[model samples]
Target: MSKMPTPPTLPTATVRPILDMNAYDGQVSAKADQGNDLLMRRTRNVGAASVLFYRDPIEMVSASGCWMTASDGTNYLDFYNNVPSVGHCHPQVVSAMADQAARLNINSRYLHQTTETYLDRLKATFPDHLENVVLTCSGSEANDLALRTAQRGTGARGIIVTECAYHGNTATVTDISPSAFKRGKLPDHVVSVPAPGKLAYGDDIAGGFADAIVKAIAVLSDRGHGIAALIVDSIFSSDGVFSNPRGFLRLAVAVVHRAGGVFIADEVQPGFGRTGDAFWGFLRHDVTPDIVSMGKPMGNGFPMAGIAVRPELLAAFCEDVGYFNTFAASPVAAATGLAVLDVIRDENLLANAMICGKYLREGLQHLADIDGRISDIRGAGLFLGVDLSPNGAPEDANGQLVGDVINAMRRHRVLIGAAGKYGETLKIRPPLCLRQSEVDFFIEALGKSLRECG
Candidate 1:
């Protein structure tokens, strides 16, 4: 037999990596020379596009519940992962995945009762109108398919998204994601609008967003590419976790419909009851979306994602081209999805998120009260953002402060990340199973890091 051909490799820096902190040219760590040597070997083998967290990236070996153990035998409280929504490596999810994989892990082509059961339970969590669902292997595929459906259904090519929004990584979806582009330029068919201002309106948050969409629609219509859909991350997560002014999304949804366009809710980040009050993030806004894309936490870190749509919207797309995925909605995926839902309800994770989230926010608020560098704190449930600044003024926009805090927290054995256009907002989204004690631990670490950075 002929030898298998080796895969071609792309040169370093050819593709800008995610969360690449190349500007920070510093030593990995003074404590662990062995770990730093391993990191050097990893960079050479894993290619330049592999992004790692912290100034001295950790080598995590395993995790369970709200804690992860690094290769250096350090236990770190995980407050940066949302994919393990129910908690990392929960017994229920692990058992389901293992049991199903051992039994039958076939494709969707086969008629399986497990898939039907999982779909039935999944559909029950959503509104009645969002009854049709098409499963995909990843959120990128779901968003890509949703985009195609919107354009075909509305007979238009124009799309509108938040100025710094990121939906996914597919080629087509990337055009609509201004945050993903290093140059920050969107395609002609796509229009970007500023995200809901943090202090825009305490009670009328929907008005500004609606007005922006109205203007975008008019401009796209004038340019001959009529509006197709307006998509947003329900929590406005990347735009700095703007979840205030409940039900503010109603006006935007209405405006999209008025302009003969669809509204798509990208719930890949905020779904699975992470936002505390509801099962889906879009529900908190008191609006119905034409289509909703989900992933990440759906299978509790498994590669399962899907788009739930109104039957009418799905019908139109099906008429043109039907969706099919070999590994999507497979036996193993169905089992994993079912297990996640079971754990969320039986373990009462939503209630835990609400209680612990409030506790965490109050703790953060206390820190903000004493420190001027803590500019603003906002968000819903476990998905919160803490804005950092040197002078504590709104105009500071010091990305370095946020970066320093991240590195400091990592050194303290607490994992976290940052968000927003300038990457100045600390993104605190731990596993939904976070407890009161864990919340206190994180707060202490954060306070210490804040002081050190100051």
Candidate 2:
């Protein structure tokens, strides 16, 4: 990754789980006054699992570039969304999707030129060894397929994941996401390890991660579930955004390979040009994963995701079990994917991310220098985190500061989110096309929010 500016380190406190609306003390009726009745009716009709962000959810009507216009005509600077990697509703992507939909949208069974062209372009973004791809409509499905492929290819059932890691929402994937477990328990076939942290491991972060994976592999094998795959969110977004010491993932990947387990990189958040240095987050670590699952920004908010795998691994799985998705790899999805690539290259968003990200981080670091609560700030490119803690202790503050800061930012019309095991980190991942002026606005808003919250 590019050596962007980094704030000084402090002990990172585990953030709380995602916010629960029921537990929120904010006035629910307030939203109803602001025309949330329709939303509430839809919410009631929708599945109970469907959740909305903010105490008063954003009834977003339109978005452009890095700003979202809410129902009440309030424009919020988007700093928490990566779904629109190129930017919200890019003209090229919208036009491509519309044109492709008007022309033809068909399944992969029938040969399609757009599908072939899209896949070729996507595969070109990956390493030479990762030549095959299986398309899915969502990241959850892609991750599920990658997991199944791992077991089929390696003939092992065990999986290793970082504690508090969230790969996807599927049944099998939920088992590996330690935070998603109902009772803080894991399945027999899965094991959780601490993600690379500054406090627990001290200087040898990579060694610590490698050792944990090795131990997890042994434990899984001894427990009769032989190691099949060790998967991770390359950015460690859920585990408080640990993206320092580039190439740290190589050590753990080597251990996984030695143990006959595939290293699967869940690049849902860090893929595309968000990482600035490279197209994929795994490449930042200089490690080649056997299976790389990507989503979120693939089609620039067009519900497209897929897994790129080594031909040998995918070939063996396909030989025994064929795969197909009804809406995946459709012509419309191909056009959207192609358009996303075009925007990234044509607009030079990667370089923008690098420059803007450095400016943002430096501004954040200046804030940290002035405020003790802004304990640690780390990550690369446009995806970054600001770890907040009380007295700089890891065990303090359940999300009071973070929640205050986030809500305060909302009041300031700058959108951002919280993450980590106490929700103490501000997860600032704006669209890759964010400019220097917008970065300055975000920094100014963040500073004011911090001061007001304090």
Candidate 3:
């Protein structure tokens, strides 16, 4: 057998100043106006115009490489999206889709080898225990399956999840996700725990988060049976991309299992090489889960999601009832997922994500000296977070400051995003193909934005 050959080294290019800064600024203004005009006249969301007052929602016309061109013909740096894992419209994936579509694009019910092959390829990325896989049309569906499977396997109804975790948008998933649905009204059968905040908790994430879960499980067990499972976003992507004490998940999962609950790692955001050090974000903690829900980057912008369960747990789920999604593991979706995996392995994007993430973290940290608004920096690989606390304190009133920074960054031709209940954290989950130049530009833009906001 031959060892896999190494990928060729990355090439560097110079950014020529052919276009003036004013030229770009004028384009951005025109683009904003155009977007506003169209959205106000044409589109509506919840009976409101597409213009959300947070600036005109970008009518992205097309994207390729690391840039997105809006309907107004102005380009913005694509740094806020993690769904385009291999870069926007990566040629390899695009070509694969075109080739496979011409050849065979069928449903899972059809007899095609690609679906099984793609499933096998995906399975190889997981541990041996997580052998059985169930594909779904989206993360919300994957999570819904995960919840149902966990309940059947554990015979428990209580679910413990991160306080700010955003698993998906379906009814069952929304019940588990308090950040979006349970806000202002607490969720039943759910125990929410705070996300890792170093300054607030003295960096003792393992102690704090674990204690919360332990107490909840004990309370639930005392009242009835134990928790059905504990669901969490491995990187807490929506909760400001938290990366902390490496072994925290290991401890938490053990506790949940000891309490007779399934350990579900929701890798919707950090799966597919976004975490770099491991193929899956939870793997970084050296912990295997009873149920692993994957989405977002799995198909690299396609609506493909899945859950890989421990064989025993899956057996329990299978015995309970027959469950199938119409589009789950469809040939086209499977091909898209397989192509994404190929790009990750062939291009060595895992290592790239880690290297580039470190570069971004260091660059952002350096700006803390220039602008104190950037209070905290945390994450692993391309998943990152920037807290807008004045002195790295958790309760600082920089919520509006963070919003101002995001809007200001838009003016600088860099599109980023913010998260956290207070909306005070810059959630920087760029596609794994992000390069150092883009990171540098983000840092400069962010620093300037912070200064201007002050």
Candidate 4:
């Protein structure tokens, strides 16, 4: 008897392992670790330890052409890469990134036209009111500036935010985020109200929005608190307020204005072309936000962010105090952002999202009929969700069924995500460049996973 002969060692960079498993797409088989001993060692204690890691945890080594390839050599059709709004490693974006890095990767202090060009491109996308932009390194930072600008412009100390909505982890935003505020007790300046949920609010979406905004303003004002801003995610991405009937936000915006509070639209999650029909989710509301904060898809995963405030607010902020960020308007980031805009327009991804998103929703509804456990299926455009509960509107999953379903999907090689306070809803936020075929694949995987979970 003899031990099997060892294969000749391949270089660390070139070694590709044939994994014993499949990715979301089986045709693109994936392996956990090929030639890297370190990865295998790390996975022993830390990898494959969670429900989300049911499949072989192959580290993705390369990505391109709307798909990602893992170390095990499996290819995944990336429907959930919103951060890469344009696409995975799009050639245009890659070339721009390389070109900018080689030429001028400097900061804003050096009076460069790159920043102006980038800002102009962004401004052109929004309505006329949101004319001024101040660049930031992230959504959280942009929100921070937005808050400061609003406070300065309106001379208000009170802020209103939606329930369960996440507006970055910054101290200011955390205070306003009721769901996030429980950490150290909510900040005194922050007030919150229920986010209109799909099942709870139904078609008459205006029932609570305006009243809630007005009430929050009154509560703070009664204590001699000035109204600073009514900051909210254009569509509450985390809290499940995908869209209230047309006039919900419009009415809320009016109330905030009447109360002398600024309306800040946090577009971190729903900005760019993710919502499909519109460039920005706030556009769906019909009322213009005094300050619009954008991120996530701005640089297509390059970590660019900004505050597009009303010109008046900009002037007030300028008069109030100086504002600057070290990496704000960095040339490379601006170039990447510019390239993203060009690619989004050239590829007509927004129209694609609109059409594909509707089809996906209809497919999910059909799936719900097949699976009673599916409590609710709601969303706008590419930002969608499938609620797992007996009642279609459970804020939280009563049992482990929803969690189990998500885990099962991963096992089947589909990498969809989950959300809701109890992780009950299966959240589907695929990249904007996603096509109908990919969604069909996801829906099929999802249907099978749901049946298996039960």
TM of each candidate vs. truth: 0.92, 0.93, 0.88, 0.85
Cand. 1 Cα-lDDT: 0.85
Top-TM-score structure, candidate number: 2
Model 3 is weakest, by summed lDDT over 10 consecutive residues, at: 14-23
Give the alpha carbon lDDT tens digit for every residue of 249-288 in model 4.
8887888888788889999888987888788888887887
- Clashing residue pairs, backbone N/CA/C < 3 A, model 3: none
Whole-model lDDT, model 4: 0.73
Judged by whole-model lDDT over C-alpha atoms, candidate 3 comes out at 0.76
Q: What tens-digit string does per-residue lDDT give for candidate 3 at 253-343?
A: 8888888898899988888888789888888888878899988877778888989998887788888795777777877787778888898
Q: What TM-score does candidate 3 reach?
A: 0.88
Which rank order by TM-score, best down to worst? Answer: 2, 1, 3, 4
What TM-score does candidate 4 reach?
0.85
| lDDT per residue as tens, model 2, 310-365 | 98888888899879999999999999999999899999988988899899999998
Give each model's whole-structure lDDT: 0.85, 0.85, 0.76, 0.73
Poorly placed runs, candidate 3 (over 4 Å): 1-37, 41-53, 182-184, 222-225, 390-392
lDDT score, residue 73, model 4?
77
